[model samples]
Target: MNAPTMKTELMDAIKYDEPFRAHAIYYAIQQGYVQIDDPYNGLPADMDYDAIKKMQHANILQMCTVKIFTIPFGQGMHAIYLANCENDARAKHFTLYRQHAQRIQNASRRMDVSLYCEETGTHEVIRETKRRAAEFPWYVGVVGW
Candidate 1:
């Protein structure tokens, strides 16, 4: 499948897990993987920034480095693994994965905007956000490919 198709599949998988979708969307926005189209929507957008931030933090903790005190996954377990090993390997791997995940989150957020704004008369904001999201590889190359 092409990139856009892959992105949509990923996003659909994420949406199937509702909690994960919320966490991912918030994380994406916080990390600047996605930019808000217009901040001047007259009324505050539906997002609860504080709640989203908390969710993002929790999601990161769940997916990234395990607490040092925790036991490591045993051999033959299907734990997520990083391929390349370099100095600061764990940190680097988490960073890269987070970045990519955030992009997917951002795209999902844009999809939400597209779905909701029409009813709210925020078409301008929707249009702009869609345009920007489409520029991202996750959206343009992978989402609908």
Candidate 2:
């Protein structure tokens, strides 16, 4: 939109995108198509050189994480059948009154979880190489939504 906003976005893009920054921005800087203040004096007053440099880290420590969702089932087969049954309100109420109360619960307890991924999803550490495995342990993970 505005010049300052676009500049900030461009700076963020160069910071987060390793390949693009390495090839394009670095090349442009080398060829004198673009210029950068080595001391980061051109940056906003709130940002320091070290802070910007920290944001430019291509490879940083990743954390291993696993999310286990526990879903509780509120009803059983009888409840499902009752819900699907085509009956009058009074008959359904009578049938429900005669049936016993039921509850279903499901959960995942303690389990081994090992695998780490970069916070930005740029690096997926699946192998136990020099980097410790800490994220995305599931071989084929999928996002439900």
Query: Global CA lDDT of candidate 2, please?
Result: 0.31
TM-score of 1: 0.20
CA lDDT scores, all candidates in order: 0.34, 0.31
Stretches of candidate 2 off by over 4 Å are: 1-11, 38-140, 143-145
Show the colliding residue pairs in model 2.
Answer: 64-134, 115-134, 115-135, 116-134, 116-135
Task: Give candidate 1 regions above 4 Å deviation.
Answer: 1-44, 64-145
Q: After superposition, how far is residue 75 of candidate 2 from its true place, in Å?
A: 27
Backbone collisions counted per model: 11, 5
Model 1: how far is 7 from its true place, Å? 10
Per-residue lDDT for 18-135 in model 1, tens only? 4445464545456655543423212224556676667756765243221111112235221122212222333433454443221111112333333224345544333334334432
lDDT of 2 by residue, 1-145 (tens): 4343323434654444333333333333444544643322232333243533443453222111222222222332122111111232223333545533343111112122233344456534222221232322222122111
* TM-score per candidate: 0.20, 0.21
Best by lDDT: 1
Which stretch of 10 consecutive residues in model 1 shows the poorest summed lDDT?
Answer: 136-145
Candidate 2 displacement at residue 57 in angstroms: 19
